[model samples]
Target: MTLLKGWRYGAFVGFIAGFIGATLYPIVISPMINSDYYKQIQKETRAGVNQEEIQPGNMKVWSDPFDRKK
Candidate 1:
């Protein structure tokens, strides 16, 4: 019924808690933390502006670190 009320049960509970946390993170936590098109309008606005409109070296930038460098 009870968990022995010491480090052993605490560790077991902690393990279960961490397991549940890791398991639920992708399902329950990731979606809320992710963003989809939240700043699309601003991005498109920047992208539409030409070099004359925006300064150099600040063009519409999209970088994915997972991809290789140019």
Candidate 2:
């Protein structure tokens, strides 16, 4: 009976921790991990600009954004 009580307590704590983490992930961890492309899209949309107009150019610092050369 005592062993069963310990197991119940452990399961309850685990469930609470998991719920809190899921609730906070988008609020806390999402921005830090979002890609630059997605971030740009969000920024443009919020500014009332057309998303398609915000196209990416060959703007990489160390490499091209294409496979073929001119």
Candidate 3:
């Protein structure tokens, strides 16, 4: 009974290790193997952030273009 339990534990550990390795292998290699994938993603995010940053002060509120109550 004890020997069977030990083998079961070993099998469980092996399954977990294999699952993690399979998942991580692609993520670890993708950025290194295809650099442009991450670069393009980051570039788009930065451009969106910059657009939002610029719009607040430099852009207009056309509804109040003529006058203001406050």
* Alpha-carbon RMSD to native, per candidate: 7.5, 8.4, 11.2
TM-scores of all predicted structures: 0.43, 0.48, 0.38
* Candidate number of the best lDDT: 3
- lDDT string for model 3 (1-70, tens) is 3554677889988999999989987889667989998899989888746554567767753465668777
Error of 2 at 20 (Å): 0.2
Per-residue accuracy of model 2 over 5-50 as CA lDDT, tens digit each: 6878899889999999999999878867877768798787789755
Error of 2 at 50 (Å): 19
Model 2 clash pairs are none
RMSD score of candidate 1 (Å): 7.5
Q: After superposition, how far is residue 4 of candidate 3 from its true place, in Å?
A: 7.7
Clash counts for all predictions: 0, 0, 0
Candidate 1 per-residue C-alpha lDDT over 1-70 given as tens digits, one digit per residue, 9 for 90 to 100: 7646788879988999999999999887876676454466568777756665555686665557699876
Please give the ranking of all candidate structures by TM-score, highest first, separated by commas: 2, 1, 3
lDDT of 3 at 66: 69
Between candidates 2 and 3, name the one with more favorable TM-score.
2
What is candidate 2's CA lDDT for residue 44?
77
What TM-score, to 2 decimals, does candidate 2 have?
Answer: 0.48
